[model samples]
Target: MEDINLTIQKGEFAAIVGPSGCGKSTILRMIAGLETPDTGEVLAEQEIIQRPSPDRMMIFQEHALYPWLTVEENVGFGLELKSVSKSERKTRVESVLKKVGLDGFQSYYPSQLSGGMRQLGLAV
Candidate 1:
């Protein structure tokens, strides 16, 4: 974590790679505002990130979905929180689930889905 500096272009597909316990998750959390740094700053889209932005989303490693909510509900939870209309939420949920190759599992609960399927819930 010494003097780390990174830059990503608009269309870049970048990833963080490191050994376990080597600060990979730390970096992500700091950028995502889930953790704070004693020094240095985390910026996104030219803005200093002081807190999590609604426009920026993080798919936690824990999946973080309510077990009682179905796949579609979990994926659309953010939109729901934003007070998006029911029809629009439904449309977006379906579209994102399909984008993640989960065309037929919208009705599935988190417990009923595989781990990878649960992870796809965050793609929305």
Candidate 2:
């Protein structure tokens, strides 16, 4: 990896393009706090990233999945880990799913969904 500096402000879309395995994802992981730099800093606002948090979310190139969980369960998994109640989690998860164009496939498993739906599932 070479030294590079870039800033993406709030309400903006930023894409990194380069050859495969050229540390494109490495940069995102550092920003998302999934990986630490050997030296230097990764900050969200004024806070230094140290670990994964809801405030700093990441969805990788590969569709992230809990193989044993259903579509609904996978979408709601984050809130579940935070100990949110079932009713509220359900409500939020459903809303998010719908926003990502998954309006009626909640009960489907990952195996039953198409690649696009699986990607949509991960987005929710």
Q: Which candidate is the best by TM-score?
A: 2
Model 2 misplacement above 4 A: 66-69, 77-92
Q: Write the per-residue lDDT of candidate 1 for residues 2-114, one digit (tens) a residue.
A: 68898887889899998999889888887777777778888888888888766566677877889999888888888899999999999988887887799799898999988
True-structure RMSD, every candidate: 3.2, 2.9
How many residue pairs collide in each prediction? 0, 0
Candidate 2: RMSD to truth: 2.9
Please provide TM-scores, in order, for all candidate models, with all chains considered together: 0.68, 0.72
On lDDT, the candidate that comes out on top is 2
Instruction: List the pairs of residues colliding in candidate 1.
Output: none
lDDT of each: 0.83, 0.85
lDDT of model 1, residue 74: 86
- lDDT tens digits, residue span 1-124, model 2: 8677778899999999999989999998988788998888888887888997767767767977877898889999989999999999999988988888887988888988998888778766
